[model samples]
Target: MVTVILTMNLSARFTVQGSGFQSSRREKYGNVFKTHLLGRPLIRVTGAENVRKILMGEHHLVSTEWPRSTRMLLGPNTVANSIGDIHRNKRKVFSKIFSHEALESYLPKIQLVIQDTLRAWSSHPEAINVYQEAQKLTFRMAIRVLLGFSIPEEDLGHLFEVYQQFVENVFSLPVDLPFSGYRRGIQARQTLQKGLEKAIREKLQCTQGKDYSDALDILIESSKEHGKEMTMQELKDGTLELIFAAYATTASASTSLIMQLLKHPAEVMRLFTPISGGYRTVLQTFELDGFQIPKGWSVMYSIRDTHDTAPVFKDVNVFDPDRFGQARSEDKDGRFHYLPFGGGVRTCLGKHLAKLFLKVLAVELASTSRFELATRTFPRITLVPVLHPVDGLSVKFFGLDSNQNKILPETEAMLSATV
Candidate 1:
């Protein structure tokens, strides 16, 4: 059985190549197949109904579980690592932070960050790497807008450096030998936690009566209001988790958004899946599509595969914005057909903020600049951890005049006018 599974997995990997591994596997093995990944037997499920069962099942049939490396690095207190009441409570506290009111408060800052970052990127003598810049941009948003930090430039740069280490190793092997990625990740996590603890202490001491609208303030206040005050350790874990959750996913999405924009100008809708899939640990033995999903095994629902194989979507590979329009309404064909933000209780808490950020970016990019791929061939996407270009997506930006016709070198006036 293991040999057959390995063969199937290898076949899937080779067949998919640049397209996607899971989608190709689905085509070969139907909507359900067992494959080993991250040192565990995983049943990879796709199709709307199959994925819907796993997603909607939540605590009853399955529970959220990332790899060992992720679990260890993210710690025990985060919403991603918790289950049952703990997850519920943490999510409740976080939901308030991403509320429409909170997002409204964050819009100006998000816009300012995007505007400034674009100007900086465009000022470069050569084409800027979209993925690299997007990472920096989202990191700034995470630090300044979400956590509301006002640290010195040196400290911010150091934090970002440490954070890159943390992110790079989150998906590494569980081995913690000295100088291993996991060991480095553990060390980086400690550094981040210390920084976050100091920030939390400063906030508590200096801003007791102040009116701040950032996520950290709201998180602290919301936790207290729930009558279950988070401990210093919990606060640190939560803050780090927020940063981790917000950083790479948004960066990857931002890059993917830009890529899609360049290819299909009218397809501004988020067809790119930043997160390839979500993981769940089976809590009970259940029959899915006549196959027994044994308890204690892992189940991975592929978001990208679901999107690809969805019969609701005509020309699934094509970027068609009209599919989402009222006349077509393809996404509405099924509950779980198009879940960029996932579904059920564990839906991404940052979905609203992410979409809003991308929307503002798209509007700003269209209004302020004319961008094109720096290279003749578009870069291929790497889908593990998150979806981003393998080459970091080199793009050159030129300023758009008031008429949105003439393209010139980006200048301060052109960038300032967009805001």
Candidate 2:
């Protein structure tokens, strides 16, 4: 099983290798069953009832777990790695920094970065790789708004290359030797951390008398609080986690959101394309809907599977966005069934920020710009860690008069209601 899974994932034609196992397995296994993946004894649980249990039962019944490559590359001190009380504290600090208030404060910075990026794109007047460009744009936001770095133009290209390699290879083999994803991720993480350490130090020294507002300032303030302070290494590890959270997943979500909006004219739609679900290591033996799941097991509640399964979503393969309308409310089939941002205490802290990022990007694209796909046919969906259109959807961009089809409020409200 490990050989089969690894062969499929590590092959030369890796980019278009999105897993279709969930669709077939849900048909055969009825949304909850044991399976082997990544050379481990694993349980793949789907459906709303089952998903609710895993996410809502976090910590007491299950604890956070990630692949070896992910754990090693991200380090142990990150909020993603901590559990129980420690996880709560780390997340609290993060929540305060990422709150709606903080988002509004950072809005000006975000607006400045995006406006400049769009203007630069306009000047090109040629086809561009939307996926790659999305990643670059999101990374710029992370650097300026989260870490407060100037990042010279000469250095930006190298910085992007390092972070790109880390994200691209984060799911590969965990071997730390040369030519391994784990090694490259480790090296890149170190390079990023060293630069962050300097930034944090300077932020602390310079912001002593003035009011501080950036994400870096929030973190530095938390680190100085008596009895609740974070250590330097913890600060650095947390920064790496922040960059990963802000840049990679948001970039992917932002890219996918635009594609969905562009295709909104079509009759069918998939509400969410989950990047990946997480593993929850069992903390004690328990029965899930009469099935015994032993302690030490690595289990994940499958988000994609639940989204595709028939019981929760009618005509699961069709692109009917209104399935989530107040009249239908298909996602309400199970209180725990629809998990776009996950569930329970461990739900993604950055979800609000990511959502806002995509919302603004969608509005900007739909309102001020007219774009045409350079490729006539739609590209295949591929999961290179995250989903991407196979060709990155090369497209030509041109400005539109701000008054055209400006996405009426009622229609926009209906679109928002769908997902």
Candidate 3:
């Protein structure tokens, strides 16, 4: 294994040229190659200490740069590309949309989405592919919450097909070779941009009201307040950027969460038990697993890694959510690990919403049915900007009795239900 000790001014790049560029390469390198792209120079980083320093550092030493492909796909003014005061201002505006009050108000809508998805899946064949289904659920939710539009079912399917192509090739070489995945992705982005521009124009003409509850509405309101409205092109780019960033990773994490729970039945039962403390217990399990990312490197934290490492918990590789019941800061080193949403200033802004969606989805699934993974071995995995099970996770769902169902309520249920 290629474990690099944390140090200052340390930088190394691992290319995907060798056969080792697959999963094993990522596992061996750990956090050291987080920022090293296929062809770019290796960015130097130590551990959490260095990650904090670089993110908080002055622009000259650790500036956020948008790769050409990302800029072309998401546009220059998107939040991912904004910097300094501009970035901070945009975050402030976006933050209001993610407030607990706002998210609470959307609970009914979220439940409706989750219920409808489960109902649809409940009727499927014994071995239904969950990866595809999860993506559909997330994409639909994005449309409802972010775009304030209800896409037709057929159109939504087509959109996912096209979006997948675009997402898969966004990091590929920019050349527009005919029939190439990169070329197809560029085309899909253009199509999405055109659609978003039309939506922005319509949103601009509407009379603002509480009923107009979507991120686009908030963005429009904020832009007007700042006297700096986005142009049609800017709106299109920014909208697509937000949708792309928010939907994929969160959905994948949720899928992984379910898989882990089902594979480890004992853990699932412990997690759902009254004594387990439900969501709090689950959160601790997520944290105890090591995500030892080094500074300067932009590595993804594999929840699987944390779940697999035995030293972190008794029978660490086993799926025992009860292990989480005993987990305390004192048990592990002082570090609070396990990063589903990453850390630092660039951490996901939609984290609150993502967690809410995942919790709701998990509750709905766990309550309504019992599911089993059909495959003996794990399916082939792929990383197209985000991780996805290439073979699609096949699962069988059996109906559950209401008495057997456990619906864990949020701490602020009284105030939120009233709101």
Candidate 4:
């Protein structure tokens, strides 16, 4: 009976609502439970130890496997689509782009972009949609810094629009009928590949006898150095994948960070998990919390659910970043208790870059501008396709004086009053 209800709820989430995978069933069904998604049998695991096994079991007990639409849309060349040695080699080449030296070079660029973007936002007299603007900001950074494409502003704007179409339909039905989301996603992918191919060719032609700085150059050089030169199509596919990794989740997290800041002024919010969970396919029948997860069955280890249900946290729902600080160190109770960036071998490759980008954005916003929620009430958050406020997080930005290091006195007082 429990299995039947779980199946129905899963069906509704994917087909009808197309949003939200979280449910209160964790309390009733325990951490490990069986369900189905898109006709594939799945075991949803939530507890820290349970998730630890799933993540650490990568390539041994399970392997990465996204949805059919996702695999088709992202193509087979991406790191997420590959397995075994192929995935490892790809990760090694990709690692160079996010190495400590590369990130140091990217710091100034990230800060400058955020400063300029927030400055422009402050100049606007009316409320601005933070989620929309954050996407544009992250997209520009990904193109200019990560891919090293110095295209014109108009062209960048057009590319961002097309990319949005691709992301919007990444989780769509596999049907390829006219005007279907999957059809539109395929079209958008083709358009993006064309643009990326042109850029790759230009870079390859002009980059001889020069040191590689940006991620694309590094990827090209690293691939050749590793004795596996990527084809034009592979480079193009990989570029799109990198942009997808850097742009969407970062934007979602940035918007959520801003919302948290506005709501809980002085306190830092650590639970900005835009991605609810990750998918893996069980390689063999494994006993997890007394349930036998059969071979070939898909497994989804829940990040949000684990954080919410971890026994270490005092008030799991409350916004308490300090629990992670030196005094309490709640997350230290277990290895997988807190996973904003995930863990194990398949941990996020761009984790450092994402954190640096958010840190810079936070510093720039706090130092340069005073912002307030434009809406009377905090907007409801939606957790499909990535977490984001349903209302786009409208806010008013005001530039501070050159010497001003913080918000105005009254604004600080108002924030304190709310706290």
TM-score of each: 0.91, 0.86, 0.74, 0.90
Please report how far candidate 2 places residue 130 from its true position, in Å: 0.9
Write down the lDDT of every candidate, Cα atoms only.
0.81, 0.71, 0.56, 0.81
Name the TM-score of candidate 1: 0.91
Can you give the lDDT of residue 419 in candidate 2?
17
Q: List model 2 lDDT by residue over 286-309, tens digit each.
A: 778667778888887776666666
Q: For candidate 3, list the clashing residue pairs, or say none.
A: 34-298, 34-299, 35-298, 45-295, 45-296, 46-295
> Candidate 1 or 3, higher TM-score?
1
What's model 1's lDDT at 38?
57
Per-residue lDDT value at 293 in model 2: 79
Runs of candidate 3 with Cα error greater than 4 angstroms are 1-36, 44-46, 58-60, 202-212, 265-336, 401-419
TM-score of candidate 2 versus the correct structure, residues matched by position: 0.86
Which regions of candidate 2 deviate over 4 angstroms? 1-19, 208-212, 265-270, 310-312, 325-329, 401-419
The positional error of residue 254 in candidate 3, measured at the CA in angstroms, is 2.1
State the local distance difference test value for candidate 2.
0.71
On TM-score, the stronger of 2 and 3 is 2
- What lDDT is obtained when candidate 3 is compared to the true structure? 0.56
Which residue pairs in model 2 clash with each other?
268-319, 269-319, 269-320
Worst 10 residues of 3 by lDDT: 274-283
